[model samples]
Target: MRLAELSERSGVSTATIKYYLRERLLPPGRRITATQSEYDEEHLRRLRLVRALIQVGRIPVGTAREVLAAVEDDSRDQLSRLGTAVEALPHGPEPDESDPSTAVGRRTATALMRQAGWRFSLGIADEFPAFRMLVGAIAALHRLGYACDLPHLLPYAQQAAQLAVADLDLVEEFTTPAEQVEAAVALTVLYEPVLLSLRRLAEAEESNRRFGGGS
Candidate 1:
């Protein structure tokens, strides 16, 4: 495809596409002439990945470049490539420093992960941004004077572990490392709402079952 076609197909402006090429965020296409280049489907795939990293993920250009490099690094194994890609994504923001629960939550988060047997899932405690998000959530409950400790959270952890396994199973259905990694990233961001909504629905059903309040 030509630059204009690539731009239209990718829903990105030609100007922005030129900028991405100059930024080396997207690899240049094959040279057909001094001023013309021919792009293929791989360029299309990469353009979307670059856009997702920048626009949806809100990662910096530098980080996105590093992530793309990692994704394209054939020397690395599939798991390593995917791990690097995922770790590059932003988890939610850190809990407020002023909140005492931030400290308490960090401790609780560590203990909970250890009890759940996932402390080493990323080869270190407090490594993934999701771990930080967990800390913030636990901290919030603690701030509310609730027992948001390991015992209280273990069942949820067990269920989440199962979901994690299922997520990996789905990612593996893709034939390539890049495709699998893209699926992993997409599922990570997109499925949280699905999971959360289902939880709420389940709670409603269980509540109605126990209380006889529904038709």
Candidate 2:
């Protein structure tokens, strides 16, 4: 299709599309004439991916480019592609290993993972900022008077591991590495809110059943 049609169909402004082209975020279209260019389904798919990463995932352009590069890299295995996608997602600040609170949090996180039998290495955790964020969250919960101990948190980790397996199964449905990466990102970024919303609803229903006057 023409540039206007591509923009219209993708819900991206022509100006932004031009900018993406200039920035090398989106590849150049097939030149039909000296000035006219045609875009195909692949272009549409890539545009959607770029938009999702930037607009929905809130990834910066440079990081988005790197993520795209990783996704498009045919040399990388499925696990590596998945890891790259996870790395590109937003994360909190890295926790200080020397800080007593962070140290406790790391131990708690490590214990939870070990109890759940989740296969992760300390090296992987150290490289991923989100791991630190997870630990920070546990520590913060403890500070906020919540039960952040291993026994209490193990159930959550177990459930998360189950969900991760399901997520991987879904990713396997896509034949191509790019498709798998896109599916992983979309599943993580888009469905996170859906999952949270459902959890909140479940909590409300449970509370109402147990404590509401209707009970």
Cα lDDT computed for each candidate against the true fold: 0.82, 0.82
TM-score, model 2 to reference: 0.89
lDDT of 1 by residue, 1-215 (tens): 99999999999999999999999999999999999999998899888878777776677888878777777778888878887777776677888879888999988888777787674653565667678888898988999998887788999999998999999998889887777777777667566678889999999999998897676
Error of 2 at 206 (Å): 1.3
Q: Candidate 1: misplaced stretches above 4 Å?
A: 54-63, 95-100, 200-212
**1-215: candidate 2 lDDT, tens digit per residue:** 99999999999999999999997889899999999999998889889988888887787899888877777777888888888877777776677566677777888988776777665645577567667788988877866678899888988877887888888898789887788887787677766777789899999989999899555
Each prediction's TM-score versus the true structure:
0.80, 0.89
Model 1 TM: 0.80
